[model samples]
Target chain A: MTQQPAKKLYIHDVCVRDGFQMESVFVPTDAKVDLINRLSLTGLAKIEVTSFSSPKAIPALADAESVLVNLNRVPTVEYTALIPNARGCERALKCELDEHNVVMSASETHNRANLRMTRDQSLAQFAEIVRLTNGTVAVNASLSTAFGCPFDGQICDDDLLANIDRIAEIGIKRLTLCDTTGMANPAQVRRICELVLTRFPELTVTAHFHNTRGMGLANCIAALEGGITRFDASLAGLGGCPFAPGASGNACTEDMVHMFNAMGYDTGIDVANLIPLANEIPSLVGHDVPGQVMKAGSYDRIYPMPDWLGGKEQTRLAGSGNALIDPECRVTEVAK
Target chain B: MTQQPAKKLYIHDVCVRDGFQMESVFVPTDAKVDLINRLSLTGLAKIEVTSFSSPKAIPALADAESVLVNLNRVPTVEYTALIPNARGCERALKCELDEHNVVMSASETHNRANLRMTRDQSLAQFAEIVRLTNGTVAVNASLSTAFGCPFDGQICDDDLLANIDRIAEIGIKRLTLCDTTGMANPAQVRRICELVLTRFPELTVTAHFHNTRGMGLANCIAALEGGITRFDASLAGLGGCPFAPGASGNACTEDMVHMFNAMGYDTGIDVANLIPLANEIPSLVGHDVPGQVMKAGSYDRIYPMPDWLGGKEQTRLAGSGNALIDPECRVTEVAK
Candidate 1:
């Protein structure tokens, strides 16, 4: 009978990693470490600290090693790092991170365009990374373009399930189904998530969605309905996809928390503390970010009563000390 | 099992009336009539054209009668007008509007502030208006501040239900529960909507939400889940409350329809045709509006297929026209 089924939803904050990866402006390593360190205290279930990609390729997160080594990890929080390839895993293993999050797009074309490898090649690389960190860390695979691909059109169900089937074969029990490029709708998300979960009941399902088409929160709600309990969100809705500039980026950490919390679903992340972090985003990224609740505030946050309503009109007495003309409110006295 | 429970969900667009009323600059009568005329053809269930309030009081919608008279009403569309008093009803009767939408706030304080009448007085006046236009037009009452009042913190459930009970007693068959300041939350919306519908099974319930706190679409989806069918949305997310300027206004018509359509619910409205109308709003209003899908295209709207993917990589061959992928996918050609 409950509308909100996720009584204690697990929120994964990805601002420092996936979000910063999109920023054209390179946030300093010290700033990244400081922000992640601050975010670690915000009651989030997980935080993806950084990506160990080649500095020549992505200079923004080039200092992944330094950020990871310097992080003041929270005891209750799981700290994961994005390992794009076996080399990235080698680099992250030195940092002694909590886990490794390997990513491969479900679409063969997107895989080739983004990772410079075919789907098969990417899966082999992921398997290599998974093998490298088999017992060293809790490794998980993120199936990007699980809903739709930018380079290609709608990802076929068999093609997507095949990728999930392949990753499951590699003993990767945890999976993050990503709507890369924000092309996911609710019905599509529900169908896909339901399909994945129903097939692999043992897999820990995490939904990573973008607000690309402005359905981030709505999609999140849908995914939750599809029995997804874990979410990946960015601070201040940062990490807007480089492809669709000025559009929705990652599902906003605070906005999602706000929505879930408002819906009576308990996501233990500190939504109030994240607002300050979301506020610092415009300055960090050097432009306005796309997060809504940060600017609009929490549903319970009361806006000041309008001046015109309180001043000349003595009907509602926040301004007036006037006694009620009719206690039952059947009639009202004329304004003095 | 069906994701789309509400097939042919009724969409009631309130752009011309509620939307324009918030504008600082006066939108001309011809423009209002033209927009309504265009909206009439968009397959919406209802359109609230204009409010029949005093022209001097609200200069923005001063020519309500002119706009109403000039409108080329589509046979399939229901045109309604907001009537503040019996005098406004008298004015609307002259134009022969399809329905009369009389509004009264659930919050006594808000009732005084916005309409300059106490809750009881507004109800009494609305009842009088209903009596005047009883058989001439369909009389529906809009209960503003049904969720929360800016001056008043949270409207109690009993008080809101009491107001609903009073209006139903007056023989009004249709009711709109409005989030006047966008203070409605999903759980609260569901609870109240369930209560009202359960108490009065025969009454048609329409939910009017604002995106002030960015919960507009989320709220709409919740209402749909709660078995409420009819909705009030404004074009281009227009009609921001005058009290809280620049924040979300009424739920954008296209955004809601887009979400519904995306979720496989049938709104019976042609969503594609409404985009042009949404696009024209920024120019007409002289300011930017808050609607998202208008800015971010529909979910399936493919973004140029990421040129680099098809160019150097040649993985997804749009330029080469490689004979259609899988034939089942309507494209062919394996990656080199």
Candidate 2:
């Protein structure tokens, strides 16, 4: 797998938007601004700052405008927000966002249940949102249930491709194929991603995966092997499918970035710097998140020898010629 | 990726031995026997019943002999046990086991820290254990930290191949490459596994992975793509690296099986039957486990619409022409 060099990968964090949207408790605007500012310095290529939805529908993100205005902008990082309709597009345009992400579902049942609109209604509304922007800001259409649906089961290849064509016709250049409710398999992900990338070579395709059934990272790998360069991930795996009962969170950000870097791809994001930020999420959300790297540490983290081994054995191990063994093993002592 | 069909896959469950060893609470011998008997019916190709290590070293499996003697074995399931030394091999031989798995570490620091023996000592002792078996039962060697070590950062490729060569020379036909602390990335796994499979075509290699760094299932995919067919998984994601602080459990059996089945591979194990058993593990171990499938149902599971949607909208949905929407969706009603 390492014999061939891979294309440079871009990691886009959706924690502040997708992740926080699922939280029942309201997060203070100052904390949201602080988190986004800290994330901006972590080398991420893009960050989804907030969602411009009706405050009554999503009370958790009612302070989206406040968060976008307060955060210190990083010139190198692209900032985007989720726009649900033409009203949302107007709000996002006022903020001078780098990108406006419009959302809809590939399946009719999901489109109705999630957005309370028919598939055609969603397409027309999305088209209006695109025209409202008028090329002032880039538009990225996120097609939910692209793999499979909780309301509607397996999505056919023809319908999925047709939906993409309609979204492209609305003048959108970027698309995110979302596995809403985490119903995707690796084989299916690889097949569909390859098909989309082949059919639309000019479009930028991003994969959005959920870890509800624990196939999130596996699907990410398949998408990567199928030539996907952009990904949507959540810090600390904080987002969940409110429609799917007992579902977990989205694909984790630090964990995904760590894998990409380990697999010899330059993601332009440092996982080590994302760890401390991820560790503080449980306190911010008032719950334990599903991130494993935050708890397990990085793969290269060297743990100290047990106390029973004593300093004599430790000293002997320190002098070993094997380069794999770190002589300074005692730098970070963890209780066994 | 699925253009060519894959070889038959074999799943081996090690929950009774490896999963319980790390638990602070000791599960009763009857429960262990019952769980193994139930697992036998799940169509698993092999089951690691228990370890014959010193009782002092693993109080959790102190009743190894009694549990192995009492469980009702299925004719199709091959039973195996972990043998730590010559004494353990003798005990396993007395039980008339189908296979005896002798373990050691590929890295010197991990070998000493985990087993209190040098690499030469472990190799010599493993050779003696193979000799003691005398062809009465199959011998499989598990090389820990084959991918990388928690104490030692990375195991060199040359050393890893050399260790495998030594194990093969000891007359062991089956070997498991263990990611002891989950230090492996997908690229490394695919590259090394391809090399091993090509060099040792006669050997049956099983991939044993830990979910410590959240790459367990992803690593499994890489290994599968590299031609590995056998896997060692733990129920409810039990078992962890004692040396790696805050490490999670092994790659979850139900989760991996779910992914494999979804990807169109026949592992001969029905994931639905394994889930109810996995759901009962937290009570058995007295804590929450890391398995995701047990909490989130299988991908095909169809949940009922929310009560607020009412019967009228649901009735319309029930009549939809799409095959994805199950008309019997109300059979399993879940509160959203």
Chain B TM-scores across candidates: 0.91, 0.91
Q: Each candidate's DockQ score against the native complex?
A: 0.27, 0.41
Model 2 Cα shift for residue A298 (angstroms)? 1.0
> For residue B266, what is the lDDT in candidate 1?
77
For candidate 1, list the clashing residue pairs, or say none: B324-B331, B324-B332, B325-B331, B325-B332
- RMSD of every candidate to native, in Å, equals 6.5, 5.3
Which tens-of-lDDT digit does each residue in A124-145 have in candidate 1?
9878987788787998899888
Q: Give the runs in model 1 whose Cα sits over 4 Å from its true position.
A: A1-6, A242-245, A303-336, B1-6, B242-246, B303-336
Q: Specify the highest-TM-score model's number.
A: 2
Measured on C-alpha atoms, candidate 1 has an lDDT of 0.80
Worst 10 residues of 2 chain A by lDDT: A327-336
